[model samples]
Target: MSTDTSSEQRIQLRLGSEAATEELARKLASALDEGCVVGLSGRLGAGKTVFCRGLAEGRGVDPREVSSPSFVYLQSYEGDSGPFHHADLYRLGSMDDAAIEEAIDGTGLQHVLGAAGLAAVEWWEFYRGPVPQKLVTVEIAVENPEYRSIELKFAGQGLQRALDAVS
Candidate 1:
């Protein structure tokens, strides 16, 4: 495991394999408190859903039950701490500001954004503006077919503590 803390409120990790990526997700899950939001940014096939599975596993949910919410938009499951909400906005392509706001309102994303539980949003760039202020941003870069570089950023005390613990 490798960690870097050079950037302000950021942690970068070099994951050698899928297992390593999942392990890092599990570690982050262990440190997250209620009402935490994890924004995931990455291209297709970057293991975003796999990382979410690890997160669900760490939160005492069945990892196998965690899947990408690409078509449905969001999926909710009972976690050890509380509710775990997962959202994928990849399918909502090219939306105007009004459409985005309407989608946020119609899907109850606004509620999830502020809810007292853990939430992970894939393709978070689509709705970045409404995400909670205290956010943990995870950006995954594909170094190879099986390798990934993940960058995490946050300023909340809970997330900072998680970073410190994992580091």
Candidate 2:
């Protein structure tokens, strides 16, 4: 697990519906611009992608374009705000040194952090390597359509806006 919680700030949220989950996504996306990365983790059927749909909608992109990149690896969506990079690292296993290098050096995933308005990584905790130092990691735990828990962890900051949105 590459999730270094030492410097990260976390907030827990209770979602009453799908809209609530998306609302949280939108609020977080609104706070991010260039040089930002967001990580997401949860169980199967945890509404991770569904939350991404909300984030894409919040960023003014077609929500349908926010599907998981498990197959393609990376999915980019452009909107009036900017580009949204949705990446699924679940299948890739550990992000080796080369992968981490890509994540920071513009030639790889890090390019998304430097350029995209929002970079949402799913199954992020599963990746064994350095996560983007400054990131907003969202963990979704769902019980049903109207009952869910969402935890927002800022890699090195607080998420007041996101908390206010879901509260």
Candidate 3:
């Protein structure tokens, strides 16, 4: 993996395969602490769920148990380190801010945000609510069928450790 030094709190990685993507995510997961929120932004089929699966495996949960919570909106798993909350906001696409907040509340996503565990939200661009203090935004760009470019922006204090771990 390669890292870009454009920003201290930001790092870019080029993943050549699905396993590489998952491995990078697993490294980040190991460095994350409780109450951390990871927002994932990528086009459909960009491997957001795959990264989450790696996060689950890193946290000592069965990777097989990780899946996209598109219909249910939110799914929680018990991990060895702590809880893992996964949310998909694709269904709330283009909603107004107020409606998005309401949907977040209605779907129990509000509870997961900044909660006591590692939270990974897919299609996080749709949410406009209050962002947690411990937030990491990951934008994955699909370069080809088997390659992806991922940029991670760490917004929380002391998040450099996570970035360092990924590198």
The numbered model that scores best in TM-score is 3
Across 1-167, the per-residue lDDT of candidate 2 in tens digits comes to: 23343465568878888777887787777766465777789987788888888888878898876777777667888877988888877765656756644543432565665464777778877544455656777888877756888888765434444434444
Please write out the lDDT profile of model 1 over residues 1-167, one tens digit for every residue. Answer: 43333334877888898888888888888788788888898999998998898888778788889888877888999977778888888866678877877776777777887587788889888883554756788899999987898998875544566787667
Model 2 alpha-carbon miss at residue 121, Å = 0.5
User: How would you order the candidates by lDDT, starting with the best?
Assistant: 3, 1, 2
Model 2: residue 51 alpha-carbon error in angstroms: 1.1
lDDT of 1: 0.80
Q: Give lDDT tens digits, candidate 3, residues 22-45.
A: 998899998988888889999999
**Model 1 CA lDDT for position 30:** 77
lDDT minimum window of 10 residues, candidate 2: 157-166
Query: How do the candidates rank by TM-score, highest first?
Result: 3, 1, 2
- Candidate 2, residue 27: Cα displacement in angstroms equals 1.7
Candidate 1: which stretches are off by over 4 Å?
A: 1-8
